[model samples]
Target: MYQPPHFKEERLDVQHALIQAHPLGLLVTNGSSGLIANPIPFALDASASPLGTLRAHLSRANQQWRDFDPAQEALVVFQGVESYITPSWYEAKRETGKVVPTWNYVIVQAYGRMRAIDDPEWLLRQISDVTRHQEAGRPEPWSTADAPADFLAAQLKGIVGVEIEVTRIEGKWKVSQNRSDTDRQRVAAGLRDDAHEEAHAMADLVETRGAKS
Candidate 1:
């Protein structure tokens, strides 16, 4: 996380909001198995600690859980709106022809001690919480109790729960903030004209966040 002074985001609530909005995090750990990374959906407990706590489950067969080193910290990266910016979209490109292409994105990185929990009760609760959070706004929300008890029990046996009490977190919002006002506004307009939803989201960020910066 090479953070420039202008792009650094230190607010705890902002970091947590990004994690909650993008729950699928890239879990990175360095252990006996060397460097391992997995994309896992996590549930955040903001009040669990001063920073926050992350709860997720991994397949029992996944070696990352077994490879956890208590002495080391694990990292989870949550990505939000992201888009590629073209120099053609910048006013500076026409004014001085000095602009180059760059990427714009919002991301959060969290670090904490990683541990695995093999208890069935904890796994059940972890899964249920994650499921409920994901299904909240759906018209037909499903629940863990919808499945047969035996089937649910059998399914639970195949996974292990993991907990991380966040010790450090960093957020980077690179949304054309470094550009001049005119250049940023032109970038946002270009992004909004793109067809992808993510680009549109990035356009909004560029306008709001760039203005603030």
Candidate 2:
């Protein structure tokens, strides 16, 4: 959460959209016991609202769900592509004696209060919707009816559904935004040639975001 001005991402709409492309977020909440974090694959519904909506489920027996009091806000973290910045990538460092290691990546943070969905039918609907979303481009799409009604009903009983209506979001795209154009170009080119897959990912992020401006 400690982000410098140079690394902060200000485009809210675009930020929201980016995370949804990979909506598996780390959900964190706090209560009397302590802080709890759950890595959940979520269904992000943009049409739900300007702040968007998050839908996910957890094991019914998992006490964490009950401890997620609606009064206490929750944080959902969507981690985008990231890569390390090698010292050799900086053209400025090649001439000047100023250089260090850093990382470039995109991440979105969503804050909101969570509410439990008690309606089994609504939960079923959400489950179906999420399945469809994930299997959108798959040749063999999976449907909710894959399981027998009795089986699904029993499975649903073992899970607790949740909805998080986002209240605030912080998007940070730390891709050498503060660097000079020449420095950025040098870094991008170097990263593109990097053997590490993560490095190439960072290069692509820089180019994609840079073009927008």
Candidate 3:
């Protein structure tokens, strides 16, 4: 998360939105055994802390959870739109041959002390929230209640829930903000032409950043 001032997104609202929009994050922790990271979906619990909290579950067998002591800190990285920026997309660079390639993207890093939530009732609620969030745009929505009694009980045994009450957040949004208007527009157009989702997303961000500027 080495963000230059030109690309740093210090807006609190933007940081929260990024984390909420992208629930899946890479949770990294440093404990007695050293560093460990896990990619998991987390729900934002605004009521839990002043800076808000994260809710996620890891498999009971996963050692990553055991390493997260209440006294230690962990980093949850929430990544938004990202894409490669080609030099050819910049009008100024194309004309003068002055610019090289770069990347445009948005990311938020949440640092906090991790806490394990072992209560069965709370874990169930957290699981339901996560499932609903992930299945938002699906055609056929699934639910924890859809499964049977014994089956659900057995399923719950394999998982453990945890929350990281976010103490610090750092946001980065590199969306061609440093580029000239003409070049930015060209970059947006070029991004739109790209076949990948991330490229199109970057194009949208470029447009939004331009509008805000």
Candidate 4:
């Protein structure tokens, strides 16, 4: 991930939390086609291993899964809020005119061995967990059981289950951590005023992570 020491996130708990917060991961595999990346929403089973396991599904028609070898490694990229940091926000920029624009973001890369599942029951369970997690706070939550059995069965048949046994995980929190406290605060303040939701999110992360350091 090309993370500098100041930007590296070494906390396991923090990395896991980021996955939970941003469950949509970019699953990447290298095969005869070179490389293919699929965006998939995953459910994490933290108890499965020290680094945790990932559960997702892809369309049965997707050839990326078929081409990938289970013995080889796959990478799941989880990205959180990101915002553009303007030099205009920095006090040092005005003092020395040396600062340039940068980006503030959080990213986690999970490396693991992936196994494909064809069992309908296991696929149903994976769908249920991920659905429940996402639908928790909705005004009217939906469940797999809400659908007709035959319809649900047919739906499951069209997709293939994916399970990843995580071997390692890396987190990078580039939330203005390299800047001084004053500059970090300034960046956060600027982000807070931005219209984008992720900008506001990055502002909070900048403040939170900086406080920890």
Best by lDDT: 1
Candidates in descending lDDT order:
1, 4, 3, 2
* Residue 148 lDDT (model 3): 99
Residue pairs that clash (backbone atoms under 3 angstroms), model 3: none
Model 2 agreement with the true structure over 48-155: per-residue lDDT tens digits = 877888888888887778886789889999998888777776776879959888888889999899988767897898889778888899989889998899999988
TM-scores for every predicted model: 0.97, 0.90, 0.92, 0.96
In angstroms, what RMSD does candidate 3 have relative to the true structure?
1.8
TM-score, model 1 to reference:
0.97
Question: Against the hidden true structure, what lDDT does model 4 obtain?
Answer: 0.91
Candidate 2 at residue 64, lDDT? 73
Worst 10 residues of 4 by lDDT: 204-213
The model with the greater lDDT, 3 or 4, is: 4
The sequence of per-residue lDDT tens digits that candidate 3 reaches over residues 1-213 is 797787888887778888888889999998778899999999997767878899999999998888766787889999898888899877766578888999787899999999876777888899999888878889999989999978988888888988888899899888988888888899999988989988888888888786334
lDDT of each: 0.92, 0.83, 0.86, 0.91
Report lDDT (Cα) of residue 202, candidate 4.
Answer: 86
